[model samples]
Target: MSDDEVLLSHDDGRGVRTLTLNRPHRKNALDDALWRALRDALAAAGEDREVRALVITGAGGAFCSGADISGGPRAEHPTYRMRMLSDVALTLHELPVPTVAKVTGVAVGAGWNLALGCDLVVATPSARFSQIFTRRGLSLDLGGSWLLPRLVGLQQAKRLALLAETLDAEQARTLNLVTWVVPESEVDAFTDGVCDRLVGGPPVALAQSKALLNEGVDRTLRDALANEARAQGVNFATRDATEAFAAFAQRRDPHFTGTWAVPPSLTDMNGSARSPGPGHEERLRQAD
Candidate 1:
C-alpha cells in the first residue's frame, strides 16, 4: 500500500520518528487502512538505524475515537474485525524501540488499547479514555481484555470495561494508566521532550532494559535474574558501555554510536525506580 492510503504521516529528526494518524475528520478512527499504515510506519522506524525513539499521536485534536463506525471498513468483515484489531495491538507490542503515545483528546475503546500498547503514554488535560464496548453490546477488542487487566489491575479494568465510563486525563493518571497529564497546548512539547531524552540515552541499554522488563512480567525471579545476568554480559562488550564508563570517569555526557550489542544484564534487571536513566527523579519531580 502506498503511504497516502494509510492516513499516516511520519517525520524523523535527531534520532526521533514521530508518526501521526492523519484521519482527523473521523477522529483518527481505526480502520484496515489506518492499521496497515500504522504497522508499516512502526516497521519503518524500527528498521531505521537513525531512529532512536518513536512517538505516536493523532493529527488535529482527538487521539482516536475507536474504530471507524462510518460503515465501510467494519461492515466489510464484521466478525473478523476482532482478530484484525487484536493483530494490530500485538504488532504495537512487538515494536523493538521505545514508543510513546501522545494523547490530546479522546481515546475510547480500541483507541484506548492502542495507547496502552506503547511503552509510555503522555496525555493532555483535555484527553479522555473510555472502554465503551459494553455500552454498545460488544466486547472489548484490540487486546483490551489482556492489556487492560495488567495495566490497572483486574478489578479496576473490569469496572471501566463493564461500566463503559469515561475517564479524564487526571483520573487516568491516578490509575497509573498514563505517565503524565499536561495542558493540551503542551502535549506536543512534552512528547518531543520525552523523545529527546530517549534518543539521547544509550540505545542498546534501553532496548535490552525494555525487553527484560516486558519478559519479567511472566517469568520467575530466578529465571529473570539469570536472564538479566546474561543480558548484562552481552551489553558489557558493547562500545556504548565503554563510552558510558568513559563518560562517567570524565564527568561528561556519553555519546553512544548505536553499534553496541545489547547486554543481557540490561535485560531482566530490576530496580526500585520506575523510570530509567539518570535524572529520572528530576523528571518525576518536575511532573509533580
Candidate 2:
C-alpha cells in the first residue's frame, strides 16, 4: 500500500466519528501500517472535543478477518509488533469517548476481540464471529484473553475459544457477544440511530459511566463506589451537565459537545497528558 492510500478513513459527522478500515481487498485485516494508522486516528479522536461518539467499521464488507498473516515479517520483529499491537488495544479500551463497532461480514480471531473491546457492537444479521486463533496455531492477542471471559463469562468464553466455533450474529447475541443485531440492509441506519442517542447525551456523564462499568469488574466494591462519586464530581463541573438538567425541564434533547471544564488533550506514549486542540497530530506531522 502506498503511504497515502488512506488505510483508515476518519469521517466526522456532527458529534460522531466513523472510522472505516480501508483495506477491503484483504477484508480489512490489520497490518503494521494499519495498526499505526488506527492508533493515531483514535488518539486524535480522543482529543477532539467535538467528537461525542466514535464508530469503527470496515470498508467493503468484512469488519476484519484478523491480522494479515500473509504479509512478510515486519522490520520491527515479533516483540515490537506485539508491543505496538498492545498499545492499540490499550488505547481502544481506555479511550475517554464511547466507541461502537459496526460489524458486517466476517469478524474472526483478533477481529472478534476488537468488536468485544468496543463499548458497544452493532452487527448485521449476516455478521459472523469466531475465535479462530487455535485454527491458525496462534494464541489470542489484542487483549482477547482479558476481554472474552468478561464479555461472555468464563464458561462460554472457554467453549468458544477451545472449540473455535463460528457464530452467526443472532447466536452471538444470545451469548451476549453482540449488543445489537439488525438486518444487513439496515445496518447503517441502525448504527446511525445508535450513534445519535450516544452523541445527544451529556458527554462527560456518558464517558464516566462507560469507565465505571468497564473498570467495575476489577474494582473492589468500595473502590468502585468511590470512583463513581469521583466520576460524578467530574461530571458536575461540566456545563453540559447543567444544560442537561435545563433541557430536561424544557423537554428538549440536550446538545453535548463532549467537552469538560478544561481544554481537550491526549496522553502520549510517555504518559504525559497535554491539550493540543483539534487536528493536533495532523498539524505536528505537517510541521515535521
Candidate 3:
C-alpha cells in the first residue's frame, strides 16, 4: 500500500470481506493517513452488496498500538489533532455493517478504542489492552470513553480509564469487552470461523439486529421496545425472514438474498454521557 493509503489489504470471498491494517511497524497505529484509509475501506465494504460480513485485523502480530504518535504531519494546533482523532472514532461507530475486530497482541490507547468500535472482538490469548493515556499524560481518545462505558459499565470504565491499567485478553473477555479469547495459534482460524457464521447467516436479519442493539443503548426502555417492535415488523416483511420461516417448516438451511438498508432513525440515534472528550490522554498524563 502507498504511504497515503492506510495499509489496507482486503480479501473478499465467501461473502466475507477481511480488511487488515497494514502499518505493522508502528503496530498499526491510526495515523492521519491510516485513519483516512480505514474510512475508505469501511465505506467500500459497506457499499459492496456481496459483502455479508466484515473483519478488521492487523497485518503483523499486534492488533494495533493506538494512535501513530510518530507518524502523520505534525499539526501546529492541538485542537485540530483532537478533532481529527474524534472524527475517526465516530466513523468507526457509524459503520453500517457489523464489524469485527480480530486482536492478536497489544491494543493500547487509540488501538484499544478501535477494537471497542467494532461490533464484536475476537482475540488471542496473548492479546493485551491498555489505556495508557494516563501514563502518557493523556486521556482516552477514539471513542474509548463512549465505547468502554457501554461495554463494561461506568465504574469499571472509570477504573480502566483513570488507572491506565493493562488488561490481558483473558481479563478483557471476563469483563465482556471481548467475545472470545483463544490460543494465539488459533486466532486466525477462530476469526475465520466467526466470519463464516456471519457470512452464511441472513444478512438482513443480522443488519437489523445490529442496528437495533446500537440504537437501543441510547434509547429509553419504552422507546427501545417500540423500536424493536418496529424493526421486527419490518423484518417480518423481508424475503430473508420469509425464507427463514419456510426453511424452519421444511427443516433445512435458509439462503438469504440482497443487501438491506439500515433504518435512518437507528443510524441517527444519539446517547448522552459525560464528554470524556478527546484530550483526556494528555490531561491524565500531566496530572500523573
Candidate 4:
C-alpha cells in the first residue's frame, strides 16, 4: 500500500475521531511506513479541536502484530528511528483529548505499547498481549519500561517483560493492562458507546482530570491536590461547565462543545464557547 493508505482516519463530526491501522494483511504490523503514518496521524489528531475523543483500532481482524521485524525501510541512525517512536508515544500520552484503544487479535511488542499509550483500552475477549521483545533477543523500548511498571506494579511488569509471555484479554484486564474485554462481535458497538460518553463530556474538564490523574502517581499528595485545585479552577471558567450547571437546574441534558483556549491552532473558535440558552436541550435532542 502507499504511505498515505497505511492509516485511515474518520471523524464523526459529533466530536469523535478514529484512526485505523490499515495494513491488515500483515495483521496491521508497524512497518516503517505505518509507523511514520501512525505518528503523523496521532500528532494531527492531538491538534484537532473537533476531536473530543479519539479511537485507535485496526482494520481486518487484528489490532496489531507489533513492529514488522522483517523487510521494510531502516533508519540509517538507530537514534532517528527510536526518536520517532518516542515522539509518537509522548504526543499520544500528552494529548489533551481522551484516546481509547479498541483492540482485537494480537497486540504485542511496540504494538502493545502503542495501545498502552492510550488513556483507555477496550478489547475483545480473545485478544492477546505480550511484551515479546525478550523473545526477539531485544530489550524493551517505546516507553514500555516506564509504562508497564506503573500500570501493573514493578514485579508483575518485570515478569511480563522478562518472560515475554502472552496474556489473554481477561488476564490483561486482571493486571489492569486492558480496560474492558467484550466479545469480538460487540467490540465496535461497545467502543462507540464509550466514545459517545466521552464526546458528551466537558472536554476541558476531562483533559484536566486526565492530566491530574496521569501525574498523581508521581506527585506528592499535597502537590496533587494543588494541581487538582488549579485544574478545577480552570474548569469552572469554561462555558461548558456553566452549561452543565444550567442544564442541571433546568432538569435537562447538557450539550458540551469543547472550547478551551490554547494554541489558537488547537481550536478553531474565535472566543470561548458560549453556554447554551433556553430550548437548547430540545434542540440538541432533535438534532440527535
The TM-score obtained by model 4 is 0.87
Q: Candidate 1 has which clashing residue pairs, if any? A: 212-268, 228-265, 230-264, 231-263, 231-264, 231-265, 232-264, 232-265, 235-263
Off by over 4 Å in 2: 1-13, 72-76, 258-288
Cα lDDT computed for each candidate against the true fold: 0.80, 0.83, 0.78, 0.85
Runs in model 4 deviating more than 4 A are: 1-4, 72-75, 260-288
Q: Write the per-residue lDDT of candidate 4 for residues 127-200, one digit (tens) a residue.
A: 89999999988898788998999999999999999999999999999999999999988988999899889988
Best by lDDT: 4
Q: Summarize candidate 3's per-residue lDDT along 1-288 as a digit string, tens digits.
A: 365344444455577777777888778877777777777777777777777778888877988888777644574877877887776667667666678899988899988888888988999888999998898788878888888889999999999999988999989999999999888888778888888888778776787788888888899999988988888877764667767777999999987773332222223336333444577556544432
10 residues in a row with least lDDT, candidate 1: 264-273
Root-mean-square deviation of candidate 2:
8.9
Q: What TM-score, computed on C-alpha atoms, does each candidate reach?
A: 0.84, 0.85, 0.83, 0.87
Give the poorly placed runs of model 3, Cα more than 4 Å off.
1-12, 71-75, 259-288
Give the 10-residue window scoring lowest on summed lDDT in candidate 3: 259-268
Q: Report the lDDT of model 2 for residue 199.
A: 77
